[model samples]
Target: MTRTVSDVIAALDAAYPRELAEPWDAVGLVCGDPAEPVERVLVCVDPVTATVDEAVETGAGLIVAHHPLLLRGVHGVGTDTTKGSLVHRMIRSGIALFCAHTNADSADPGVSDALASALGLKVLAPLAPHQVGGTTGIGRIGELAAAEPFGDFVRRVAAALPSTVPGVYGAGDPHRPIRTVAVSGGSGDSYLDAACAAGVDAYVTADLRHHPAGEQLEAGGPALVGVTHWASEWPWCGQAAEVVRAAGNVEVHVSTRCTDPWSLRA
Candidate 1:
């Protein structure tokens, strides 16, 4: 039986419930007809031209992105703007777009879970459990498969995530013993307090701005390892693809293309 776009979205919705999403998030289908039969899918962290190009080249019928393409309000999707151009291109190429965003962040086996798996963390619980979803929330608190020096843990993370410019950065003593950790994909500075509260040895996440990080470390918070936002979230693409694949008869491909905005580091 041929599954329509609706089936794919339904599968995604089941795996990453919209109800779990933050109130401000833009989730669900962004474009393409629900009735359109889907033969192939491409899962990615960002919905940029590069990923879209991959979808077009591979003849993928749908692209499931972790980040919302039209996250902010846009009065028009006219071909004049770069974002608009991508929208027009996808439409003309018969490709559909779907965004999971924050909802995927809070799912039981969600974005953070995938990141934890990639980093070999034995997930114990959520860093910030949502009031509604039992044991499902913003980030994951876990322990390493084996305790290693803080420096070794940093090296492990560098090897685990997809390499990109501005490689992983660490805060706190490199000699500090690290066993337990809390991980959240993408920008996770917001969870610094939760990570501290969880009393984990370390916190692994992306996009850790300086001021907050300095303050956290100054105030005797957990060790921090910050990687590229894209690298941090890339693992979820594979997890998401697997969910969709298990749901129906669809050839799902996790895009290896680096959509991380940082091309070079000075």
Candidate 2:
């Protein structure tokens, strides 16, 4: 039984439907012939140069990414540009690229859901529940089972995610008790209001802005636990790989390379 790129794409869309993605997001097959036979697939948080190398080295016919390589409109994909170079490399290697950004986030067992499960939280519902579907939305609100100190919860988050250079950081008093929690993998400062409205004890997310975070805390919202964008969303790679594996007899590989732009911290 041979699975083509289109077959794998259909499977991915079923898990994270294209309709669920943000209007501005560029989700779906970026480049590849639908009829191209796919024998192996590589999953990663980012579709950067390093991960592309990993796919080529691993002989992966398809690359499933959480973030799109080219999100905004581009005039050209010449080899001169960074994204263009990636497109060239993948095309030369006969590799297909597909992204599942906001759509995956809006799915029931999406990125945030994976993060919530890793922290051992019993999910209550989506943090910003979509009115249309009711079941699917971005982010999630859940309970920690037993209330733990803010400091302990931070430790648990660090342990659950992939270790990064900056690691995890927390705001608010370490002694604060945390029972109900909200999580939004990747850049989630925008969901502060949603997390606050849910009345969670803490919010675990990535890319917290200085002003927004400070203002939220000043207003006495949920305690903020910040993590690397890569670490926050890394858990979804395994889940996505499993989805692909279940869809077909293709080999699925999760890239171990740390594609996080931040390589060092002082």
Candidate 3:
């Protein structure tokens, strides 16, 4: 059965409300005509150059992403600028782009919850609880059934995430048992203070810059597990795809391409 872009948009908007996005944030349809018939959907953490190519190769009519393609306003749509280039590519190929971003991160079964499950961690509470009409915020704090040493937990995280060389940013003692864990998916430095506030044994996330990691460590913060931004959030694409598929069986493919935007050296 054929589905329109509007169908997918409706399903996503229902799941992750556009209204829930931060005032400065952009969420929902960024490209493509809602009237266009969507036979195939591609999901990814970031709608980067390679992921876009993957979408094209997979014959996707729509690309659902976790990050907004046009977060800040652009002065021009020329191919010279990165955002413009991507916009041009999508328009040229007739591929639609949609971003869930902070809205998805703040949803009930959102980024943190999905990552927690992938690492076999059971959620105790939200690290930063998601507020729905003065409800709460949605970053998760959780625990493994049996407490594992920080080293072992790091290995588990490295295994769970997709990466060439995943870096472990161990903050506390390596021998420390990590029972209560806090996790936020993308660039989560701001939440380090929150994790410390919660007194979590460890906090796992991506794109941990050197200074912040060092500062947090010296400050005796949670043990850190820093992963590639792509690997840290790739699991979210599947979660989103499931949400879309469950709405109705529209051909959904989680793009297998690595869109990390970096090549790590050993």
Order of the predicted models by lDDT, top scorer first: 2, 1, 3
lDDT of 2 at 55: 97
Could you give me the TM-score of model 1 versus the true structure? 0.97
**Alpha carbon lDDT of residue 118, candidate 2?**
91
Per-candidate Cα lDDT values, in order, are 0.93, 0.93, 0.84
For 1-266, candidate 1 gives per-residue lDDT tens digits of 88889999999999999999888889988889999999999999999999999999999999999999988888999999999999999999999999999999999999999999999999899989987447899899999877899999999999999999889988889999999999999899899989998899999998888998999899999999999999999999999999999877899999999988899777
lDDT of 2 by residue, 1-266 (tens): 99999999999999999899999999999998889999999999999999999999999999999999999999999999999999999999999999999999999889999999999999988988888448799899899889999999999999998889999999999999999999999999899888988889999999999998999899999999999999999999999999999987899999999988888888
Candidate 2 global CA lDDT score: 0.93
* Residue 151, model 2: Cα distance from true site in angstroms: 0.5
lDDT, candidate 1, at 125? 92
Candidate 2 wrongly placed segments (more than 4 Å) = none
* TM per prediction: 0.97, 0.97, 0.92
What residue pairs are clashing in model 2? none
List clash counts for every candidate, in order: 0, 0, 9
